[model samples]
Target: MSQELHPNGALNQANELSSMHGAELTERYNKSLLGVFGTPSRVLVRGAGCHVWDADGNRYLDLLGGIAVNTLGHANPLLTSVITSQLATLGHVSNFFSTPTQIALAEKLLEISAAPAGSKVFFTNSGTEANEAALKLTRRNVGTEQTPRTKVIALEHSFHGRTLGALSLTYKHKYREPFAPLPDNVSWIPAGDIQALREAVDETVAAVFIEPIQGEAGVRELETEYLRAAREITQAAGALLVFDEVQTGMGRTGQFFASAPVLPDVMTLAKGLGGGFPIGAMIVFGEENTSWLTPGDHGTTFGGNPVACAAGLAVIHTIENEKLLEHVRETGDWLRAALAELDGISAVRGRGLLTAFELQTAVAPKFVSAALDAGFIVNATDEHTIRLAPPLIITREQLETFLAAVPQLLTAAV
Candidate 1:
């Protein structure tokens, strides 16, 4: 059994956590909630900074940051203030009318993608929606080839999103198997295999959607040689190189957009980009890709809500003002080195604050539960791998403490 630290003085209490505040209330959602994610472990009630208190009043340090969504930390004042102020003034107005926040965010995204000055952007409310938009744009660019603009090359173990269109691009067998015949013309090649990419891609391909760093594949990073080869092959095939930065964008990987020397024709962003709000964008560079959809090609309600855009703007500004990129770079190196010393661990990979480590055994699910008992929270991407994508605002000291205790936590795993 674990214990909780008392609020005021010192003593920790046994985590006999009889009943969390919202535990009972959450029980009613079991079947009605759909078994997609299964029953959640705890009924969380409040969150501040990187800590969350469950219904039972147990506080835990959240290292996953809601799967890397809370970039500035939970309930960040800057984001909250901006949302409150914006909601007070203006909320959702249809796309029929243009709002400054929407336009401004679109322009800011273009600037960050480093696309040519006149690059265009389309905003959505989630990473999947952005991928949908990008897919449409790709179809438009290919324009009815002999194979009908057929064939898409995506890396193995890549996770784009859940929507039918996005799922077609996502390579998870389970997600794709059950939902068979997803928007077709998609194929897969090993993530870092240059030869595979070279052979798999050609004029028949429409686009190559890839994550600069594969978050779902346990933070498997694509080597530079691989990225370079992908660029060459995709270009030779006349296929657009699409970088899905849904998990690595907005300073998560120490870059506004995760890429190397070659700029992607299309970049899809979500997750940390909006700081805790839901907002996504599909960036199109060059006139050829920019003009994919002129009008009435695709549309969504609440895609560019002014409130969401405000949150995104504040997030980007905070990242710049606070210089979070440097923090991620330094802290990431420190965490990686420290984890190397932790027992039951094997290898670590990733960049900036996005990192994943493989344990020597396939007990990560047990390990993750034990981590919660130890006052820390993490997500296991695989049966043998744990991923760490803490909020970019986490201090060096916090990570050091977590890393130092990882060995002991691993020992506790059954």
Candidate 2:
């Protein structure tokens, strides 16, 4: 038998990885990596456009889009070119300094967000970090020590992030319980309950966090009226309103922001921000809200690095240049309509490319497995809910392939 390879030995054999099949790679993965994410379903080798191939040479349509992060899809020429060019010139700099690419990206974000004068941005490397920074901003709104505004409001069925601070605001027990005694005083009101919100916000509240479309909760959308009421309620009570658009921001929801016009005092973004590159940001609206965080209050080492910012800029420019926003709206409508007519679908919900469909029976897991076997990548958010946040660059013909297979997949699942 061949000698067992140590973890470091495996790392040294990186060149040989391409030759390893899925089973061998998976077995090695289980031995060397932490089990938090469990076993990965496939050993994806490479990708182009909306398609990826496994180590065993299986080609699959990637419908999950790296959980909605690959805004321009895989191997996007523009995104790749910008990132490489920036890296060749100036890849990273200390937070004590900033690059032109970083500054331009922040400016573009403010503009697309329609943020008012004196708005500012804090950069981070992922969605959880963005939410962490926003949480700190809310804490800055603390009143006098005697009557500190410590209470935070988040909707039931909401998901913020897994980090300690962001996790405090998340509602699921399974996610929150093990990390017992999270930042205290976070209240969860039923989503879309205006009266409950009215009762929850008060002078002692620091902030209210909302996700316009709750992606993890099966793409449940909070009505526009409720969003408006949230704005009103938070403003009246002197509590900052925060929109966690980590999954719905960028061009994922057709519009740049899902709750556009109904703006929030603070907005957190990630996922699609840098196409496939990792980047995140927290936008503080208006001069007053922007002043809440000073230089020493927060910072990140690789947050505003030139290459990531360059990637972000390319994503925005491409989205605009290609008129993807309009395409997303049109395509999303077509996909949802088509999904609704599928045999096993019970209901479809979402706006733009961020969508979820409920099954008539609890077969989402089985259906997802069948989908994987049939050369498609999809996500089962729960027993009956399957979410689809395909790459913004995915075409109708690409989506149709999965659509055509759904009937057979559903039957196989049952």
Candidate 3:
């Protein structure tokens, strides 16, 4: 038997839970939530601009930007207002219905992508879902069940998503081993290896997925020459080229899409698409590819919710209005140059705000812990790599503070 509480009692209970400090909240989280993420470093209460306050009332600069999801930073007034206003007007409707906000967002995505006239967009609740939809769309290019173009190519060290279909395309052994036998016939190629891509992609191949900047793989990048070669190879073989720009898109690389001029047949976007709000998009370029996924082929209940679409619009509008692309380019250059000169730093890689540096010693975990203790937030992608993806709005002065403390942080870690 369960005990029932009065409405006021439930409200009070919520208030009490919200008022709890870091340690208590962490304990509650451990008990209530799944342990897949391990223990969170801090129970953050609130955020503003480029900083967040933990439940214990300590402030820390947010350099990871919610793993490159918070495009406009935390608690942005414009984003907040847009979301609230849309919620008040129309929050959600089934996929059977359409909304102005959703239509406008689709139009905007196609425009920014420089997609051809007949290009189309499919909305989803997350990057994983977007990738899943893309996988299905790619399968459409496969001739038929009896004589199917069964091969799909993806780069080694890539992280697509955790879902089964997207997981099949992801190249990590650890992530795939637990799932056992994902969708078959997917081939893994080395990143930026034009020869491997050319050799792998043939008429029997349906599609090839590439991340312009491989964020989870320590900000590894695919060069333009390689991308162009991929385009040519896939085109010659009549296979689709897909760019998974979940991390590098939406002004993260100081551009709308990281791989420009060298376009793909399909592109998937999320992460920063809604500026912290949950939304993902799969843009299929050209008339032929756009027509592949017809009605009833793929559908999502809350994919194109009005509120989420409104949030995406606000993020894009803010980026344009604030001219953040230029800011990201300039600041990213400065930040990378500074990181390269720091002690114990061996190499810096990345374009715009999506950046990472290798440590001389394999103490990235310790370095990250020290950074958190010093009121700065960063991520260790591996034992030797630290990735930084601060909010686009973060200023030079704020980054300078972190830069100044790097030597001391490295010393502490060592």
Candidate 4:
């Protein structure tokens, strides 16, 4: 009988369990965890900067950046310090009492939003919760009117979140049909069609939710002109324009808010807001008390926990002090140009660090698998589109490494 050897050589039972590889963890996961996400591609153990190591000790360049949640990359020192310190000092307080951390983060979000003076914020635990808040706020904005606005218009191929209310606003039928009877009066129109938007947004609508860049829908971008039209049409009809910036906010798009050009009346942000810590926020701008949600109308127990807020403040501070916005702009441009020139790439489009490319051959998953085998992480948004949202702090040298491997990776898939 042959003894099974560990990756490092010796294999005692204790050593084997201690050094459990990706396959072993995956098997355990199958028995104990829900299968909602299907089989995860890897059982990663640790991450640093733009790189992650799986249980098998294989290191891969992380281009997905925790699905765009890791703004400062994995295990960022500055963000970790803030989180640890805040947790040690004051980790969480119920919504009954306000904390400076919450107020400071809200003020920061408002500033980044470039909202008016009296603009207010509502915090949540995730993007879905933030969108939920937006939905409720939209409904509440119809202050004591004879006929309250009840309709919501969202763009087709858009993704808001998975909650009951947010799912109603989402455009994917597959995700919505399973949980039917979602909050009523939601309609969808093809994105980037100004005419469609003009027709759909009417006086009966409470809000029109749009993703400045539809990250999940293959990183599709809604044109600035289309957004402007939405704003104009929604405003004229007294409908609030809600921009779901969950994937595009927090310096992912160079600008602090992707809705900066269109200036949406309301915006929901999360993903990288806490630089890997979980936190989400909804900003309601426009005339001061015009759209404010009354107290007790919307609330969250752990929405603005001090630790998360501290982590968020650290993320913003690092972006400013380290000048990551400018870095994203420069690195993203170089990457887009490089990807466009790649042998298998057909088209490249996105803003700042959030980007995607169309493959000449419709085999994005194949390419993704090949990239993984070659020690790189990338996402296949669809059969033909591969999305890249590497950390905002990903360096030029690290990008060069991935760029150098592109042709071979694509060739393997081909």
lDDT of each: 0.85, 0.93, 0.93, 0.87
Residue pairs clashing in model 3 are none
lDDT of 3 by residue, 99-156 (tens): 9999999999999888888999999999999999999999989766665798999999
Question: Cα deviation of 124 in candidate 1 (Å)?
Answer: 0.4
RMSD of each: 6.5, 3.7, 2.8, 5.2
Better of 1 and 3 by TM-score: 3
All candidates' TM-scores? 0.93, 0.96, 0.96, 0.93
Candidate 2 lDDT over 1-414, as tens digits, reads: 333565455555764887999999999999999999999999998999999999999999999999999998899999999998998899778898999999999999999999999999888999999999999999989987788898999999999999999999999999999999888989999999999999999989999999999999999999999999999999998999999999999999899999998989999999999998999999999999988988698888999888999999999999999999999999999999999999889999888899999999999999999999999999999999999999998899999999999999999999
How accurate locally is residue 386 in candidate 2, as Cα lDDT from 0 to 100? 97
Off by over 4 Å in 3: 1-11, 144-147
Better of 2 and 3 by lDDT: 2
The number of the candidate with the highest lDDT is 2
Give stretches of model 1 more than 4 Å off: 1-22, 143-148
Q: Indicate the TM-score of model 4.
A: 0.93
Scored by lDDT, model 2 comes in at 0.93
Clash pairs, model 4 backbone: none
Worst 10 residues of 1 by lDDT: 8-17
